[model samples]
Target chain A: MSGLEGLYQQIILDHSKARHGDGPLEHAAAEHHEYNPTCGDELTMRIRLDDAGERIEELAWQGDGCSISMASASALVDLMAGRTLEEAGERIDAFRAMLRSQGAGEPDEELLEDAIAFHGVSKYVMRVKCAMLSWVALEACLTEARATRG
Target chain B: MEGMSSDTLGARRVADLRLDFPVFRDAGEHAPAYLDSAATSQRPARVLDAEREYLEHHLAPVHRGASAAVGRSTTLFEDARATVARFVGAGERELVWAENATDALNIVALGMADASAGLGGAEASRFALHPGDELVVVEAEHHANLIPWQRLAARTGAVLRPVRVDARGLWGPAELAAVLSPRTRVVAFAEVSNVTGFLAPVAELVALVRERSPEALVVLDACQSVPHRPSDLAASGVDFAAFSGHKMLGPNGIGGLYGRAELLDALPPARTGGSTITRVTLEHAEFLPAPHRFEAGTQPVSQVVALAEAARYLDELGMAEVARHESALAARMAEAVAELPGVRLIGPPPGEERAGLVSVVVDDVHAHDVGQYLDEAGVVVRVGHHCAQPLHRALGVTATTRASAHVYTTEDEVDRFIDALGGVRRFFGVAGAGEQTGVVA
Candidate 1:
């Protein structure tokens, strides 16, 4: 595939068009806003923790951005919906590492699922922020949720 | 071709002119259509050679030692100042070397701030701002022109009155006149808006400011205009103007700050150090005249020399011819982009006059995506708020994709841009019938 094809995979395009968990969630425990100043891409990520505050019960977002950012948000919802907060944090780290590796780090499909499509995004330094915007917002939301719980 | 008949001077053909720019020559057939000249222009071989020749042969401290090398360096530096000042239609003493256009503007604003704090004494009192005085600025101004005034206002208890732009991200003399008051201390605006490509009627606005607030100093952000169009700072009647070299086929790290001679002499120098002062005591020091007073530290002598070469290059090409070519390109780009469905041109409508740039918003596609698509097609452009966030916000879009031109830009490149943009909606499946499998509703 050409570099542009790799960056804009069909799966990523599909996910962007049919965004999952793409609205304001009611009774959210924590919400965080992330902005990419360079291109003006912005997102508001919301999450609800379970009663035990260990697992993510719900995850949703509302934002305007490119296909990479919107698709990353949708894929994040699919990957972290029912995962434990600890597992989600680990996944965020792995995804960030893969994106920053400049097409070197091999992403485990089992861990990343549809988000492995973003492996090609790692090669383009400018697009890494777009792919990571939602994940960063999710991390911040989780941090806020944990702080509130404490 | 409207102005083409009047002046046959300069390199009339862009194909022939492209040879002078080494980047285009080196890139050969695969060169991306460089449509981002509004951000920074490509340097010509003459400009590069001028800088290299100075640094390789005669590198010395300027305006310092009485050595032969120092004298030669100072002569070259001051000669460059003359060339650039003449290009902008100013006296050599009125132009001061600065880091860039932003730094040049900061010098003016900071100098005023210092004056407000009683720095330059009685002569500087003209610049001092009172508590309720107003500093008028256009809402569509780039952050470089807007933020300094904001900081100056914050420091001097001055009120910032923004002349709001319309939905198209443009403000006229009427908007400026409405915001002007008797208490207005400074009215800062751009000669040509970086985002909207709107060429301001500077003389008209200056006249309005003079009529409404006679004491107010008019500052022109000439970063866009001085590089692309014909400019005469003295004739425009602005008290001060700033422009950078990099955007005019010159080296980075050098720019010009043009001030009326008397005003420059009266305004206090914000930066004070080695070369600017005449005599220093333990407690106080007296500064030199206008240009020297503003120039504090060691200068970018090599860059200044190259900037002069760039000025000569443009002069050989004749600014009128350059402006005519770029304006044609802009109209072509705007008209073509307007024809494309779902694309909204941001500046003056087709058939109206604007600068040699076109900014557009593609429905349902972010400018980042548009830029990536254009990049893949080998059509370079500028995307994002372009450091004019308030203007973008006022236009009800976060960002817009801008395609700008210089003497080297071609019709084929503009066509490529239009072609690439036409496919953006379909590629993203936002327009026309396409695969709609995953849509939630």
Candidate 2:
């Protein structure tokens, strides 16, 4: 019930207007394109990592889609911006579980605050694809980042 | 659905033609009148019974076996073909059965692929496409007609050029003449446009093709026209035309591809595995001529038979009468919707030039929301870009809600549609009107 059902949610609308994931990356590894063909939503998620392998770095995403996909990408980048590879990986898995609602170890506390608003989204199953699209892209970017850094 | 002007067709109110469709009968009493016939017409008792009878009593593999049942089935199949031919004003020899109009059009485009690949001999000469050649189709063509030609042009390195329709979705003589150049080797069009209901002038367009791009064979997507109009395909001068049985109150899996005999003879087969060939060799194969060449495998015999029944049903009703019935309904629907607020009606708007369908955009509301709202009130209409994504893009919207009519559609259904649509703005809270008479102007 707590999903971003209303397209006019003030903070979400403001964040969408403010543009969260437009950062300039100094050094980036790989850029991945994710598209929700059914609804014509598309986004390219890019990740930047330093040589240390486990430390913080920059992330940027750009494209067009519905409010949910764009907002999810915005909130996802906010979380993954400075988190370490392992912590990001854990968060991505937890987010995936939360979206799918598997009865596993409870997702990390912070992701639940804004990110778990999407947890109620699975109840409206069709929109779950839109809600989880960015998280999947983030997961993909992390996997690619890990492969290159290792 | 249009509002009923007294429940009479020509004279008196009778055993409603609307009640013949079982869905309406089963849906309690007074269901939402299904006005979207161009999307797909509801099947009547005869078409349904014919389908069930064929499946129950006459099911058999077509054109291969020497068994008595097989022979009877093949006879039934070919008889169905003849029915479709007669319905479309074609000879039995010229019409080939396809899964649907999409499959029929794809068969033409894909057969061209086989031709370009140099498979069919002299027969494919007319279908050949080369670099810098042009494939001309109108922009308002349904995706079924537009995409295959696009893929064909891409495959052959030919330019897929479109003759444009303006903001009101009208195709003009001069615009079409400008596009039908010498380099244009194939021109595909819809007799009745799927979205806007803008009826393209086939004869005039064919005359232009003959005068300018003489070598360009004309392919007509008759999916919209054949169902609604009593057509004489042979007289139209189109080389290849496709139509679906389902849209005309027949079984879903059967459609007809009408080609002028020589065109069918020359067009290469898109799918070739069985039933098409007379003799199969390790290196070479000799295929059967015309209709059979395109029919690669076991035909949908039951659907074909039921389609014949469906054709007979329409024929019995008199296609001209059905056309008149639907035309009056479409005009009324347009008039009613035009009066409602925020409804910018698409296309030529209930004139002699329009087809049996109409699309509209409501100001400041999404088509899906409109569809959902209408569905709640027991009205059904297709929402979204309607597979003409580029057309909608040209119209500067992602989607529009479309409602179409057929013989079975009653005027009261159209009234229900208009009345229900008037309630959408309030449902979405986009406009503050409690009664939903939110005027766009």
> Highest DockQ: which candidate?
1
Best by TM-score: 1
Q: What is the lDDT of residue A68 in candidate 2?
A: 55
| Candidate 2: CAPRI quality band | incorrect
Candidate 2 whole-model C-alpha lDDT, 0 to 1:
0.77
Candidate 1 chain B weakest ten by summed lDDT: B432-441
lDDT of 2 by residue, B1-441 (tens): 344352444432423765677887677555765766777888988788988888888888888769999998889989888888998999988999899999999999998987887778776766787889999988878889999998998899999888887887668678888888889888888888888888778898889889999788899999999998889999999999999988999878889999999888888888987888988889888888988988887778888999999888888778877777767777876787778777789988654546667788887666755665576567778876777877777787767889888776776777788887776665444455544463211
Cα lDDT, model 2, residue B222 = 93
Each candidate: what lDDT? 0.90, 0.77
**lDDT per residue as tens, model 2, A34-111:** 876555556787887776766548888886654456667787877787888788888877777776763234545675
Estimate how well candidate 2 is docked, as a DockQ score: 0.14
* lDDT of candidate 1 over B77-180, digit per residue (tens): 99999999999999999999999999999999999999999999999999999799999999999999999999999999999999999988888987888889
Instruction: For every candidate, give the share of true A-B contacts it also has.
Output: 0.72, 0.00
How high is the TM-score of chain A in model 1? 0.97
